[model samples]
Target: MARENGLQKSLFALLAEAHPEAIVTLQYQYRMNKDIMTISNTLIYDNKLKCASKSVAQRQLDLPHFQQALDSIHGGASCTKQSCWIEQILDPSRKVVFLDTDKMSATEERIMETVVNKAEASIVLQLAEALLLAGVPEERLAVISVYRSQLRLISQSLRGRPGVEIATIDKYQGRDKECVLVSLVRSNETGKTGELLRDWRRINVAFTRAKSKIIIIGSSTTLSTTALFGIFLELMRTNNWIYQLHLGAENEHTIQPPPSPREKRNREHKTHSPAEAILKNRPILRDVYNSSSL
Candidate 1:
């Protein structure tokens, strides 16, 4: 049957290859918000993908419900100094978020043949619970991971809520959710992202599965060692979408959001000379300028 359709290729791929002129690529995606679609559009589709409509492109999660949920969870303090990072990532306005775990002790461990990161699992669980508390239906949320062991750990923790899908990234192809929480559980000192993440198709699928918001939890220092993820990190940094997870006393944790574009621009205007502003705006030139004596 596989050979009859096309050996090692999907039937659609085979048809598209045979009838190149007849093939029509879909340019407008209705599943993800424009911000959520940026990664896949820039990396996989060469910026060809666009939002189907302004409403779809600008849609965000329910902010009032999210704030209420945070208040209930944090005892009426929705945006405390320690937990402000949570609000920033969960803020209905933010469609794409990267929760960088580089500063935390989120190392991955090999369980016999499979790999799992307990820290990643715990953070995912917390986020899921908070979303559920925020009035997001279980069916509208999903937790995805590339590692089977990591999925298993998250599944076991979230077993009581079976409606919230917790599965491997490959299982989530052609499926989407209102909110998608991704756990990239491969933190280490040597910066190994594993063979699974090297496949751009998987990354594209994982990133483009959310309708309103997509929150990725991972170690930037480790994942940035790779070419694709290095580009992704730079994109996130440039857009000020990366938030660092800081672990405090008594197992307490905090995440601080990067400055907004306006704030960054204002700071630069005040602190930098004209030449410095030019270098600051162009990071590549800034690196070169720093390395040179002049």
Candidate 2:
């Protein structure tokens, strides 16, 4: 099982490379707006296997209604005529948002044998409830995270609610919905990411799961320290897809770390049994074991 856990060795990976023509890319995306598509494109642009509809013309694009809705919501004359009408209509403050929290608050906890970010979970719950109030169909919305604990926490909050799926990134793969809200739960003084950072495939799966819109709630400051996330946040900034609750606080700052070996030290230690302790206490038995070992 351990040997077969590799992505490259997976059946899907083999099939993808073996028969490229057999794979079909869905060009016409009714799920996400052009802006969301653009952001997603930037994230996976460097991928070896490219999307067939790289050009807008080939993709059969449709006009996003958020701009029209915004005009109606606040009258046409209020907003300046800009190229990014979708953002103007939806408002970055609501559509694509970042909720920052302290390192202490963002700490992970083991619940039901799963690691969950309680701070992030709480924020997602608030957002989900708000979205529900905004008349978003419960069936059309999903809450995704990289940790099972977070999923467990979110699932509990939305319990008995129909059509709302809460899952981890791996579980969300190959699934699409109208809206997805991702909770990137890692936060600390050091810009340390867990196993999730190294798994770009899972990250890609999580980001691309949404059809209409995605609201990402996370610690931008901590995330920007990593290469992949730094690029993701940069694209958000460049595209004006960022919605901030706090003003004049620069959250996305890049500190370029010199390239070196990226090594991760395991923080978890294995537990020893009482029988193991008793064996160690007996020096004569331990010595005989050592002598036979040679």
Candidate 3:
């Protein structure tokens, strides 16, 4: 399996070489949560969404363009996790779910499993971003976890935002989304790395949950990119992967989004500051929440 994956990695590298602008096929970060939510109690029209003092995600909520993006999401994008999102686009009532670790409340078994197995937790913020753009009300959306405490922090990131709720991956396991957006965060040989396979199976589980499509936000390095000391660097010097994804529609729903830039360490800007949140283990939705301390 590892060797097969290695070949896939080589192909990806070739594709990356010929097409340097390619983004990772594996996509969206995974998240954690605990609970069995039927319907969200929140609303998107709340005042918190309008404040520039919040997540770019929140700021995005109020934009007419953002709403347009959701309305424009007509599908055909290649994602296993995306199947549900596409359906949600076609049918707003379609169920949507996010997967992540959920058992870290006190036992920390899942978290430890992830950590000891070389796991770097991933959060589904981008899938949430796409859903947010697709007009899925936060309340209609659900976040599920394998470990509750592990996901609590991720849940807090989307908290008070409106239209979304949290749940456990177990609850949504048997269910399907119109499309599924599985986010893979950190995958190393640790608990997280071992969980990488489990996560992959879970992702397969998540993908099958979607009746139509599945989109993955994972390590582009897995196939095309390479990770040296945990930093993502491209390896393929030949094939260039973008053309494969861009085989047809030269203009339509085609143009691949740019891969994260080299300076990606600072990509989130002030609003989507994962580092700040990681440092504090709390959501810091501002330009510089650390300014006061600085």
Candidate 4:
């Protein structure tokens, strides 16, 4: 008999109920590396689901060694694996990190009745370009966000860059990538960031897609309001996987809250020189830029 619904509501149960022996569980996950797997595993730990058989490869590749060898070929001697501005996330050893950013200005745009955070697109483009320069093949990288408008902003910069996919999180649900950069576009002091926080399943899928590295860019203060993200942030702190970009000398809290009358006047009077403008948008080399620069 043909069912009206093309998708079964309980396919797994039906399969198990009909023929217990027909279910063959595939436990081996060849997609994500151990570091990415750890993050994914922690998220699902309480679900009590028997998933991702423990036999997944611990090391996907000798990332540090490879980078060193590449640098040597390029006339740079004794290169470290974490050489770029992405030291917090990209490593040959463990490739997972959380980067906290002061919310850059966002222009609110609506698409399909959903609001999109357009501010994050610039940061996302900077990150993708940095990764490309760091020897991650354009073919194996993806930049995913929850909003189509954000993707559109990124697509403008990444246009004609072959093999690099910029898409919404839903498009990436079943897809895998060697490196995945996620733009968590909402960062506000009031904790009014929308469905992105509430959609944990999409977030899970985004985290699990990376085989080698996962770089999550968002505001720590905003994310800390959510339980899942809070735990993840704490874990990153405990493991030293959290990194922050120092946008300016002023406290970051100033970026999140709406400008008061005095602050608005200060901003209106403030002017950035050409060098400062360049520095703000340019990708930084972590090893080169010391804490003083931050």
RMSD of each: 22.7, 19.7, 22.2, 15.3
Off by over 4 Å in 1: 1-19, 75-83, 248-250, 253-294
C-alpha TM-score for every candidate: 0.77, 0.61, 0.33, 0.63
| lDDT of candidates 1 onward, in order | 0.80, 0.60, 0.36, 0.65
Select the stronger candidate by lDDT from 1 and 2.
1
**Candidate 4 lDDT for residue 244:** 68
lDDT tens per residue, model 4, 29-60 = 67776677767667764433333545454545
- Please, what are the lDDT tens digits per residue for candidate 1 over residues 1-294? 655755756677778889999978789878888888888877888889899999888988764487676665565433464555565667787778898887888888988989898988878877787778778888999999898889989887676676899888999999999999999998999988888899888888999889988999999989989999998988888878888887621134332223445666788779867778678669888878878956
The TM-score obtained by model 4 is 0.63
Please give the range of 10 consecutive residues that has the lowest summed lDDT in model 1.
Answer: 248-257
**Candidate 2 clash pair list:** 31-211, 31-212, 32-211
Candidate ordering by TM-score (highest first): 1, 4, 2, 3
TM-score of 3: 0.33
Better of 3 and 4 by TM-score: 4
Scored by TM-score, the top model is 1
- lDDT score at residue 53, model 2, on the 0-100 scale: 47
lDDT for residue 280 in candidate 1, whole number 0-100: 62
Candidate 4: list runs displaced more than 4 Å: 1-27, 47-56, 60-84, 87-89, 103-119, 248-294
In TM-score terms, candidate 1 sits at: 0.77
